[model samples]
Target: MDTLIFVLFLYVLLTIPVFVLLMLFAVLTRSARLRRAAEVVSLSACAALLVLTFERAFEKPLLWIVVVLLVAVLAFGVSTIVKAARERP
Candidate 1:
């Protein structure tokens, strides 16, 4: 379990920059596909973060902030995906 948590932490750390780059490209290119990809990366990252937090049993106040941020990111990703779907022909 500790190994899994550590791996997830690493995954989240690695994806942060990728996610930012994806979002930047999505915005610059004005592509729905890029936007969707960025959201998917964000959603996965959120899931990883959530798992990490849960594995630690929410032992720290800092983890509470992580939980809040994860919830917000999940909400944002869902909303963006839904909106993109609705916009698609």
Candidate 2:
């Protein structure tokens, strides 16, 4: 399906920033836990992004639900990293 391929392409484009940020965060952070968290957050966000695209392609009314959930996840991940940074001596 051309639409599916297009959605996949768009998903890759959208996720590139998340991937770069995760890579940078993992490389810059000294804590093993932080690096592992980055991996988890990145993978989860990528999966969510893919789902969002699929939902969008089908014109699903529940697309907003996926968007909200993804935003919440990203916010949680960022907060966790910031909390760790602040607690470091």
Candidate 3:
């Protein structure tokens, strides 16, 4: 129980930055599709984060999977922002 709480605390901490960066990209880019896609994904991630918060048992290695997914999302946003900047008129 305590362990799950700690993991969730960390997840929430990590989620904030990822969400912020995604939101920034959505706001800066003129692509409505990109913004909509990002919003859906990020919101779903938040829902998953909530589910993980109450988990009392699981393979410990799942934490690594969670971190990887979060990082991948952040990396995708970074790539999108870079591409948008380069392609701007």
Candidate 4:
């Protein structure tokens, strides 16, 4: 239970900056290091989410956490698309 809470906490807190950093990276130089970090964090979070969803341990309130995760994922996607559009000739 403690471990689950910790993971949820990490996801909630870290996701904010993760989205911001991803968007920030979209605007700034195409640094591979930042790109890799973003990919790892996002991927790890996604995998964790999948496992939690399947495990059936998270309670009702945790659904809100899932919503936040969805928003973060959307942010990442939108930022990537907008960045791509801005870079086009």
Candidate 5:
């Protein structure tokens, strides 16, 4: 279980950049659908990770790191939503 948590932690750490790149791609393409999809998927995945982290007993440091990542993902997701809402139809 510990090994699984550690692997998941590493996976999240690595995918942070991938998520950023995906958002960038959405922005570059000027596709609201793509942006919304990316935000939804990213936020869902991050929330799942957070839930998994909390479900198991883990070190404080690892929990803190996951919390921080969750916050970042939340912020990004909110910003994307607001931006999409503000754009002219």
Candidate 6:
């Protein structure tokens, strides 16, 4: 569990900066591909952080909230990825 948490923490830490940079580049260049990449990265980072939180506080009432949020984020991520794939040239 400790190792899992550490890995997730590291993933979030690394992806967040990449997400931010992708978003900035997308905005500057008006690139849809970059924007979608940024969205995926952001969602992945959010889900990782949420999982880390959920693991650390599994016994808390807040666990339910985290679970709900994690589900929502994952669902949204899947839907967006599918949509992007369908729209690909």
TM-score for each prediction?
Answer: 0.75, 0.46, 0.40, 0.47, 0.51, 0.78
Off by over 4 Å in 4: 2-6, 9-13, 57-89
Q: Best lDDT goes to which candidate?
A: 6
Clashing pairs in 4: none
Candidate 3 overall lDDT versus native: 0.63
lDDT of 1 by residue, 1-89 (tens): 77888899999998899989998999999987887787788799889988888656557666777777778888887887888788878
Q: What is the C-alpha lDDT of each candidate?
A: 0.83, 0.67, 0.63, 0.66, 0.72, 0.85
Steric clash count of candidate 6: 0
| Cα lDDT for residue 77, candidate 2 | 74
Segments of candidate 5 deviating more than 4 angstroms: 52-89
Clashing pairs in 2: none
* Candidate 6 backbone collisions, by pair: none
lDDT of 4: 0.66
The 10-residue segment of model 5 with minimum total lDDT is: 53-62
* Candidate 6 residue 89 C-alpha distance from true site, Å: 4.2
Ranking by lDDT: 6, 1, 5, 2, 4, 3
The candidate scoring highest on TM-score is: 6
Clashes of 3: 0
lDDT of 4 by residue, 5-63 (tens): 57875785686688678857955977755765676676556656655553553466667
Worst 10 residues of 3 by lDDT: 50-59
Alpha-carbon shift of residue 21 in model 3 (angstroms):
0.8
Residue-wise lDDT of candidate 2 within 1-89, one digit each (tens)? Answer: 66766676676576677667767776887657656665665756556575655567467767776666767777777677678779888
- Tell me the lDDT of candidate 6: 0.85
Give the per-residue lDDT of model 3 (tens digit) for 1-89.
66766776676667677767767787898666566566655655555564563252255655766656656665676677668768877
